[model samples]
Target: MYLYYSFIRVFKYLCRERERRGQTMYLRSAARGFLAFLLLVSALHGYHDWTVTYTSSTVCALRGSTVEVSCSYEYPDKLQNRSTPVETLWFTKEDHSQPGGLVSDTDYAGRVERSCEEHSCSLSSCSGNCTLRIRDLRQSDSAEYKVRFITNQPGGEYTGDPGVKLTVTDLKVKVPHWIRLWKYLECQSMCVLSDHPNYVWYKNGQHAEREITKMFYIKEGDSVSCAVEGSERFHSPLVCAKGIKNLCNKVTYSTRTMCVLQGTSVDISCTYSTYRGLKLKEKYWYAWSNNNEPTDLQKDSEYKGRVQYPVKERGGSTLKITDLRDTDSAEYRFKYKSKSHEWKSALHGTTLTVTGLRVEGAAVAPVTEGQRVTLSCSTRCLLPGQTSYIWYHNKGPVAEPESTMNKLVLDPVGLQHAGSYSCSVRGYPHQSPEETLTVSCIMCILCRD
Candidate 1:
C-alpha cells in the first residue's frame, strides 16, 4: 500500500509540474509510460519463488500513532511437510536463529504485537503472510525492519534483505516573522505524509473552524498550534505570533495555502518591511522553481497576459492572475530589496492549488436493485468559503431536498434512480461531466421469464 501510495504522489506531483509549465500531452504520456514500466518491474520482482514482498519499502508515520508493517512470503510448498517446525521472527537488530533477535526481546516488549495468517502456530511459526504492529511510536523506533524464517532443512534459513524502513516524526508549528497584518503559520513534518491527512488547528487551546486558513489574522497575544485531524492529543507546541521579536526584515503572505477553481481569478497578496533606515529599491512576486533563480512575474513570458501586479497599498503587494488554469498551481513568494539588505521569508510561501469538480463512484459495476449506492462531488482540495453542493439528474436539477449535500446516497435504490448524474458547487457556474448509473433488477428479469 505504501509503495502504491508513493507512486500516486509522484504521479500527481509530476502532472502538476507539467501542467503548470504548459507542457505538451506527449510529455504527460511519457510520464505515464515510465510509471507503467516501474510497476511492471515491481510486479515481476514480487512474484519470484523464495521471496518476501513488503507492502512499502519505506514508511513515514507520526509519533504516537500506531504503525503496522506487513509482508507476504513464499517458500517451496515442500516445507509444509517438515517436522523440525518453522520459526518466524521480526527484528531490527542482527539476525539470530529464533530465541534472540525478536522485537519482543528488545525495548518494545509491551507495545509490540505480532500476527500471521496461521493462527494455530502462534508463538513464532508462520507461513505465507505476517504483520508487525507497534503502538505509541517514538522517534527512537525509526529503523530498518526485517523478518527471518528458519527451517530444519539444510540451506532453509532465509532472511528478507533491504527490509522496510520506518521514520517517525512529530509535527511542529513553523512561525514566520512578519511585520504585516496577517501572520501565516505552517504545520510541518520532517517527512512527507503519504496519506495527506487533514489538519486541525487550535487557538489558545480552543478549537478553530475547519475552513479557517493559516492566513487568518492573529491577535497580538494569541497562540496557535496544529495537529493531524485524528491525533489531536499530539498537537505541536503553541507558538505565539507576538513572540516573534525580529519582524523588521520579513515578507509574509496573506494565506499559507489556497484551493481555487479553474477558469477563476485569484489574488496572491503579501506585505513586507525592512529596518527603519533601509531604503526600498525593488519589490516583486516570483513563483518558486527548482534550481532556478527567481524572476519577476511581469517579465515571465509564460504568464504573458495572465499575470498582473496591482497598485501597491502602503506596505503590501498583490499578484492577480486571471483566466486561471490548472497549470497555475505553484508556490509563490514576495521579495523586496533595500540598498544594503534584501529579504524574503525563509519559510515557504503560499501554495495555490487549482482544481475542478468531478463526480466519483459513478462508474462502478451495475448495482443490483435493493442495494445502496452513493455518489460524491469530489475536488482535489476543498474550495474556499462556505461550500454547498448542487446535484443534477440528467441535465436538470435534482428535486430531492437533500441534493444540497456533497454526497447523494440512495438507500435501497430502485430502477427510477438510474440515470445520468452530475454535480456543481453553489455560486459556481461550472458543473462536472455527466456520469451514468445503471441499476439491474432481479425481479424484472424473473418476470420476463
Candidate 2:
C-alpha cells in the first residue's frame, strides 16, 4: 500500500514537472521518480521478514459506533531452546523509533481496545493475530491505523508499513420509497460499515424495537427512522412519508404506590415494551418530589452505594433500594432507552413511603381502675399532611375520636383497655405489631366485716 501511495506522489510530481518544461526537465523528473520507486521496493523487500496482513485495508464506520480492525502477523523463528516474549500494539502513528509506539492520542484514551490470540507459541518464538476495537467513533477519528509487535529477541520489533484506513461517517435514514404492495417501509442507513449491526427502529419519535432488518410496516401519518445499535446516542433524524403523527410504543411500570419499613430494602418493579425490532440500550431509576423534574438516582449522592437495579428480561426490570430512609420517600420512576431514543420514563411512576415502626408505650402494663394510662404510636419523621393515624385494639380499630393522634389516652384505666393495642398510619398497608396491655381490678374491704 505504501508503495502504491509513493508511486502516486511521484507520478504527480513528474506530471507537474513535465507541464512546466520541455524534454530536459521531463527526463530529470522521470529519473528521480524511478530512483524513488527503487528505494521503496528495497524497503518493502526488507520489511517482508515480519509481514502483517489486515482483514481489510479500509473500513467505513458510523460515528458513535464501534469498529474492529483485525490483522495477522508472521515472523521468523528464533534459535531453539530460547524463549522470547511477544507484545502487540495498535496505533495510528509510526513512531517505533521511541521505546513507546502505542502511545495513543488523548482523544482515544479509554475508547481503544486491543486483543491478541497466539496461533502458535513454542520455546523458540510466538506468532498471533491481533484485533483493535474502537468505541464511540467520531468524525475526527478517521485515520490510518497500524499494528506493531515487539519481542524480547534482538531486532524483533516490526510495524506494518501500510496500515488500515478508517472512514467515519454520520448516520442518515434513507427512505427511497415505501413498498405499498409489501406493506412495509424500507429504511436504510446512508452508509453502514459493520456487516451485521443491530438496528434500532423508531416511529413518530418513540422507540419500537431492535429490528432485524431495516424494514417496517408503514403506518399512515407516522414518521419512521432507523439507527445503528450503539450509535443510537447520535440518532438519525426522523423521516416521515404519509402522516406526521402516529402511536409510539414506550415503557410501563408495575405499581404506582409502595410502602416499606425503614432500614429495609424494597424492590421497585416494572415491565416495558418498545418497537418489536428495537434493542434496549440503557436503563436506570430516577425520582422526583413535589412536581420537581426527575433526577437520576444513580448519579444522586444520597442514593450512592445504597441503590441497585437488577437486570431482567427484555420486558421486565427492578430497582432495589437498601437502608431506606424517610428522605428516600419520593415518587420513583423507571427510565430506559434504545438506540434511537433518549432517556424515557414510564407513564406511570411508583411512589415510595419509608416509615419507621415503634410503639411509644410498654406492651404489658398492670394498672388499677381510676388510674390514667397512655399509649402512643409514632414514626421517626412526621407523616405527610394527608397521612392519618389509626389506633387498633386486639387487631381491631379503636372506636375513639382521639385515636388519630400520636398518643391514645385512657382517661380512667379499665379492663376494656387490657387487650392488645397498636397503631398505624391510614393509607399504609401495614400497622405496628400488636402489644399487650394488662389491667388490674381495684377492691375495697368493709369495716363492719
Candidate 3:
C-alpha cells in the first residue's frame, strides 16, 4: 500500500513541477499516466471487500467428506496490510434471519481448518484469492456460510460486506450388498449428487468420463464411484460440487468381486483369513445347471480345476477352471467350516458359456441348364461334436429314401432348378440359423445369402 501511494504522490509532484516550469507537453502527460496507473491498481483491490451479492453458489459433499469455499477480493494497494489485521471469521449461518441462535455450533470452529489458501492477490490480480478448507465432514454440519472482512486503516477500523450466501448440500449412497461388475464388457456406473449436468464416474480412483453404466448394469471386475456436478472425478470418498441444491450431498461406492467360471475352466477366489496363506484345496467340483434347481453337492460329471483362494491366508472356497467344455457349466456348491464352531453359509452361482459362430461350405451347386453340370453340397454339426445334418425345403424335412445321414443331390438340371435351396444341421448351444442358396444366373452364382 505504501509503495503504490508513494509512487502516486511522486507522479503528482512531477505533474505539478512540469506545469510550473512550463516543461514539454510529453513530460506533463507521462506524469498524469503514471498517476492513473497507480490509482487503478489500488482501486481494483477495493472491490474485494464488497457484498457477495453478485452470485449465489452451492457446495455438495458427503456424510464424512470435506469441501473448500473460496472468496476473493480486489482493493486499492493503500488498503492492503502484510499482517492479519482483521480476523477472517468463517461460520455456518443456520438461519441469518432467525431471531434465535444457530444449531450447528457443535465444535465446528475447531474441526474446520483451511487446507488450501492464497493471499498473493495483488490489488489488481487478487480478485480471485481468499478461500477456506473444512474437513472431517458430517451431515448435520450442512448449512449456508457467511463471510465478513474487517480492516484497520490509519484513519479508522471498519468492516466490509455481509451475508455472502454459501449453500451447503449433502450426498446419499445406497450400495446394498455385493456388487459384481463384468469384465471385458462395456460397463460404467456412477453415484450422482450434483445439480450440474456434467456427470462423472470413477473406477479404482481414475476419471471415467465415457462410462454410461451408472448403477445401471453389473457383471464382474468393475466397481462403482461418482462425483458432484462440477467435480472432475470422485477421486475422494466424498464428491464436492457447486451450482446445486442439497448441494453438499455425496455418496460412496463399492462392488463385489467376481467368481469366474468357464466351460473348460473354473477359476474361483475368496477374500478371508487363513494361517498358511490361501492356496488350492483338493476338493470335488459340484454344480447344478440352472437357477430353478437346488444347489447339489453330487460331484459334477466332468470338472477341470480345484477350489482356489484369493489374498493368501484367507478362508474361502472358490472354484477355478481351465480347458472347459459346454457341459462343464452349472451352479457350483461348496462348504467350509472354520477352525472355530462358527459356520457361515455363502453361495455364489453363475452359468458360464462361450458364444460361437461357424460356417461349413455346403456341397457344390446343382448343374446349370445350358452347360455340362456338376452338383456338390455338404452337411456339418457346427458345435464341438454332435455331427448330424438334414435337408429342408418349403415343407419340413425332405428326408432321403428312409436313410440316416443328411445329403443333397441335384437331378438333371434346368432353368427351373435355379430356385431357393436350404440345409439344416443340428446340435449344441442353440439351434443353428438356416443358410440359403439363392441361385441367380448363378453360373455367375456367387450368392451372399
lDDT of 2 by residue, 1-449 (tens): 67667877877777777768655666676778678878878787555757789999889887756789999987766544566567887777544564233434555644567888865755534568999888767788888988778876568788875899998886556665567722354445444456777777776545776765555666554455566666554455555454323323444456545666677788888765554435777777888554666666878899999988776666778888888888998878777667876544323367777887666675354776677887767664434334456888888887873333467888798777888887776655567877788777776313333
List where candidate 3 sits over 4 angstroms from the true fold.
1-56, 75-84, 93-106, 115-128, 154-449
TM-score, one value per model: 0.48, 0.40, 0.29
Cα lDDT over the full model 2: 0.68
Ranking by lDDT: 1, 2, 3
lDDT of 1 by residue, 314-348 (tens): 67899999888888899998887778766643345
After superposing candidate 1, which stretches have Cα over 4 Å from the reference? 1-247, 344-346, 401-404
Number of the candidate with higher TM-score, 2 or 3: 2
In model 1, what lDDT does residue 438 have? Answer: 93
Lowest summed lDDT window (length 10), candidate 1 = 118-127
Better of 2 and 3 by lDDT: 2
Write down the RMSD of candidate 1 (Cα, Å): 24.0
Report the Cα RMSD per candidate: 24.0, 26.6, 27.3
TM-score of candidate 1 on Cα atoms, chains taken together: 0.48
lDDT of each: 0.74, 0.68, 0.40
Residue 365, model 1, lDDT? 81
